[model samples]
Target chain A: MNPVRTTLVWAVLVVAIAVPIAAAAVSPLLAWRSPAYIAAGFAGIIAMALLLVQPLLIGGYLPGLPAPRGRRIHRVIGAVLVIAVAIHVAGLWITSPPDVIDALLFASPTPFSDWGVIAMWAVTGAAVLAAFRRRFRMRVRTWRHAHTSLAAIVVVCSVVHALLIEGTMETLSKVALCTLVVLAAIKVGVDLRVWAVRR
Target chain B: MSVDLFTRRTLLVAGGAIAATWGGGLHVPAQAQGLAPTPSMRGGSNNYIPNAPIVERIGGGGFWMTGTVRRAGDGAPLAGQRIQIWAHTTEGYESDPHSHGATLTDENGEFRLEMPQIVPAFGQPHGHLAYDSDGFETVFLRPVMPSSKDTSLRADFVLRPV
Candidate 1:
């Protein structure tokens, strides 16, 4: 990459990650909240930000990273995403068990809760599929198709889920981050022709 | 190898377009629009025992919130557990005068708190409570809203051992 282009890429990446965080930091709600709640809310936001990075990594669009290295980092970040979701849900459960139970049972009156639960389960399904990929002994094309389809579900549902929730996350920044995540995933999915891969 | 139809330049342009469209349509914060606050926004998981002195009170009036903190599975009462309570009232957030209070569980793991008479605002007249103890997992209760004409509320907590 040219030096100017490389610098621009880094700058864009930094801004994409930093903007949402800065917005959340300045949230009016943060001033009156407990530390545990703050940590939980930020964990969810950080998880959303990581969604953007995951697609970039898969596409090898991040500067200085080789394709293989990016894939490895992608897997590592996938695990981090799982942990982040765990913290987010666990925090919510501790704060309100009935609500979490309602969400899990698909009975929560809040539309955002339903979307969040669906996205959480979809992400977990993708992770489990990835872990068991070898044992399945599937053809390469079949595996890619399945994986990419799950990725699509993870991306779309997570974005919708985050956007629907009007909580700790600042509105404009959250929407911006979510849009970027969807765009990145779509770009990578398109570039890779994940849907068309065949044995 | 899979065929790539989107070149780097095209992908970048698409991303930029998405960013521009999204950035141009920003709106005010969601809370201002009457959306319910998530547990984290209200305050994170209530896991740690508050260090302040615990007030023990027994009263019933406009609304009295009472509960027992017990161990999950075993159903043992967690005595001496610290519980923090707060709520948004018609007056203001919990930080405003007479909107927040804390107490400790008695030997039987029972706690009682007196809530301010709050007219519904933002959402409903509700009380927020958090239970914390040395060895039990932290438990946070949602803002409890009065269901009927009852002036007393019971919001029990069952915490797992960590």
Candidate 2:
């Protein structure tokens, strides 16, 4: 499929997934028990897992991709992950508005809220720094350093948020997401260590 | 609800006079002085701690609200209020590249919400509520979205007339 077309398709799919979740706002009964939410949450976790690795996946750190193909794949995965996270966040919001607010504002008075809020801020900062890297005349090394740091923060916080929350994930999905978070973090750490040693 | 036409006329005339004077940069508008701080919503990340648990207070207003919502009657809990909230962050607007949104309420009338926690102290995050046949419009109660958390804080809105 054409990349642009594929992007459009995924965007719509995300909205389609988000609407019901938002509409379910009127009734919790319409939420929590729905399979759509479960599917979306797990799917989002998987896509986000890919998103976390996108820099390396695109930078040819992975074995299979030629430089150009790696770059293209990374971009595709990043876009897909954005859509996935949206569905994930939206679904959670529909289930519990107050709790969602708690997470976003770090006001839930729950420890998980702190982690979630921190992850959100880190993700935002990373995106901004990456976008303006060229304009700011940042050294490629510095940009890479900043990007990697922020990405790590995002992954760590998101994993914590997902793990602590009792809703949606349940036993199996929770285990799967946690596993992905750990594996991704470990791989990133190993890659960083190797890069440092080579330097 | 008696309308005092004489007072109303004088007030209207004063308001027009003030507008005309302000247009020419003459006198400062009287309306500007006594304006109370209206509650505003914000989204993004912040750290807000309220000073009082009895009075509904949100600390630091930007993209998020970190205050407590409580009941006015006997301080009992108000469990099910459908709240729809959205806001922007540094990365995008609510429901956009830099935003987050949610719909939820407390199970026992006391809920804690965290949306995008922005820190502008005056702007309220845009929010909607479903009163659930309680004769309250979605807009009846003042909604605030603070960007940080307040430990043991409560912001109460009285639904019935005092």
Candidate 3:
């Protein structure tokens, strides 16, 4: 990549990741919150930020990195995303088991709970399918199609879940980051053109 | 390359187009009324103690609250009742500083607590109090906002028998 172009790409990446994080750091809600809750909330926000990176990596949009290299980083980041989510839920569970149970059982009165649970299941399903892909002997075309479809579901549901919750996250920055995540994923999905591939 | 494969230029263009449309309307519904703030409930990992150590008083700085625990049906004072209180203050929330404490009621089913003056992040200055005793259903009183004009506050709780 040329020097000017590389600088521009890096600037975009930094701004995209940093803006939301900076906003979260300055949230008024952190003033009187416990350490554990703060940790859990920030972990969730980091996971959401990671979602943006995954698509950019998959689409080969990061300057100076080959698509194959980006894919490798994508897999590593995916594992981190799972861990972050676990921390988020576990923290909540520790605080209130009854509430967590309600959310998992789909009996929670909170609408955000339903969306979060759906997105969580989608993410887990995608991870499991990727893990067992070789064992199932699935064709490349079929696997890609399923993977892309699940990715879309994950992005949409996760964004909606984040947007619905009026919690620690600052509203404007959260919405902006979620919108970027959706746009990035859709852009990559369109680029892959999975639907047009012949079996 | 496969017939369905897209060129790099196509991906870039698509990404730009999607970005351009993001500023438009995208609505997320508001949370239903009566939903509790999730942060206020974080009592740490070992929140459940079989026996909470008894303390004479729980906070400091001229802010005191005295209350009595009684049975809902007959208004009988219930002694030895364990009460747990947590709140967020200017310093931080419970577990951050000295924002949480526990105490047992005296012989007359009355308890006195000393707490730092609180100013909550979102709502009015408040505290969370819970009562648990044998043969009685657990009771939780949340967002117990204090009146600034009064140095000493009177807040009582009535528990229902199981």
Query: A117, model 3: CA deviation in Å?
Result: 1.9
Query: Of the true contacts between chains A and B, what fraction does model 2 have?
Result: 0.00
- Full-model lDDT for every candidate: 0.70, 0.48, 0.70
Point out where model 3 deviates above 4 Å: A197-199, B1-162
lDDT for residue A167 in candidate 2, whole number 0-100: 38
TM, chain A, every candidate = 0.95, 0.64, 0.95
lDDT, residue A89, model 1: 87
Off by over 4 Å in 2: A1-43, A51-63, A66-68, A170-173, A192-199, B1-162
How far residue A22's Cα lies from its native spot in candidate 2, in Å, is: 23
Stretch of 10 with least lDDT, candidate 3 chain B: B27-36
Tell me the tens digit of each residue's lDDT in model 1 across A103-157: 7887754566777888898889878877888999999778888878887888888
Give the Cα RMSD of candidate 1. 19.3
List clashing residue pairs in candidate 1: A36-B44, A37-B44
List-wise, what DockQ does each model earn? 0.03, 0.02, 0.08
Scored against the true structure, residue B117 in model 1 reaches a CA lDDT of 47
TM-score winner between 1 and 3, please give it. Answer: 3
Q: Residue B162 of model 1: what lDDT?
A: 74
Which candidate comes out best when scored by TM-score? 3
